[model samples]
Every structure is written in structure tokens, then in C-alpha cells.
Target: MMTKFKRLALAAAFGTAVATSALAHSSKETTSPADGSTVAQPPEAIVMTFDAPMRITLIQVTGKDGTNYPVTRTDNMAPSKTFQAVPAALPDGSYTVNWRGLAEDGHAMDGSFTFSVGN
Candidate 1:
């Protein structure tokens, strides 16, 4: 049995613990160059960075028309805090980068983003 005052204290402690745990969970904090950025020259590679370390298994870049870009290189710079992939110079028009990875907590993350190349 618990009194009203005791119940309130227990509730507050539980809430604080939950909130702290949630904050500790791995999440995407930032991305280099930002999500949607226009570059004057074609980028030598495509990189998607995250806050927590991720196990990136696959990454693909495709032209606006859906043609897969030639992947020249792919590297996991830091498996604990970042995931990156590099490719040759892309052609003009819009391009999309599709990535699949496992978060530090073992959860899978899959998403895509598009950017432009030239005039």
C-alpha cells in the first residue's frame, strides 16, 4: 500500500527515468551540407551522417530518371557516430540517395533524399 504523497514521488521518479532513457536513445542529430543543399560543382561523393553510430549496409544514388549512379567507393568512417558513402561525379539534373542502416540500438533505418546537379 502507498499513500498519495508516496505515489506522487514514485510517479515523478519514474517519469524522469523514462525521459532520460528516451533521450539516451540513438537519434540522427545532424547531416553534413544539410538535407537539401545546392552545390555549384558536383560533389565528389555523397555522405549521410548521423548523430549516433550506425551500421550502414547499403547506400545507393540514382539519377532523377531512376538510373543508379556508379558507386566508386563506400566507407564507414566511424561506425560509432557516422556513416558515409562516396561516388564519382554525378550528371546533371536531380539525384536521389537511398540509404539503409541499422541504428546503434539494432533498429533499422531506411530513407532517401534528392538534390540537384547542374543547370
Candidate 2:
């Protein structure tokens, strides 16, 4: 036997909770070489920018022919809004950068971006 005011209050509380949860997830804001972009030369470094601080746990770069390229992380696994890694000299090809991280809210997040190097 809930009163009208109590029902309204409950609905409001639920809505607020939903909104907060949605906002808690951190997301990638941008990347170096830019997602789906073409570069004239090999990029010196791989970079990611997030809307919130994120602890980057793993990152890998793979070529179109199933070749894996190693990258040296500059962040040392520390939480940061911007993460960077230096890649070895890359040949002309399409590459995908896959990454996994822990968000400030204690959620695991993963994403991928693609770029091509060519004239």
C-alpha cells in the first residue's frame, strides 16, 4: 500500500541510479593516428585518450596479415587520461590497436582502433 508520493519518490530514485551507472563508464575520447585514418608514414607512437582516468592493462598492435607488433608502453600501467606506447618501425599496412583497461569506477573496458600507413 504505497502512497502516490512514495511511488514517485521510488521512481525518481531508480532513475537517478540508472543515470549514475551510465555515466560511470569511462570511454575512449580519441587516438593518435586517429581511428580509421590513413597516415603517410609509420606513426612514432600509439596513443589513446579517455574521458576519465583509466589503468591500461594490455595493448597490442596487429597487422592485416596476422602479424603482431610489440609496443613499449610509456604509462607503466598507471592510471591516466592519456596513454601512449612506442611502436617499432612499421611497414606500410593496415593495423589494429586493441587495448584493455580498468576504469576509475572499477570496471573493465576494452576497445580497438584501426589505421593504415601509406603514401
Name the candidate that leads on TM-score: 2
The RMSD of every model to the true structure, in order and in angstroms, is 2.9, 1.3
Error of 1 at 71 (Å): 3.1
Model 2 agreement with the true structure over 1-119: per-residue lDDT tens digits: 99999999999999999999988899999999899999999999999999999999999999999999999886878999999999989999999999999999999999999999996
Question: Which stretches of candidate 2 lie above 4 Å from their native place?
Answer: none
What is candidate 1's local distance difference test score? 0.70
Which residue pairs clash in candidate 1? 53-80
TM-score of 2: 0.92
lDDT of 1 by residue, 28-75 (tens): 655543566666677766666677887777778888787888665445
For every model shown, what is its TM-score relative to the native structure?
A: 0.71, 0.92
Candidate 2, position 115, lDDT: 99
Q: Where is the poorest 10-residue window by lDDT in model 1?
A: 72-81
RMSD of 2: 1.3
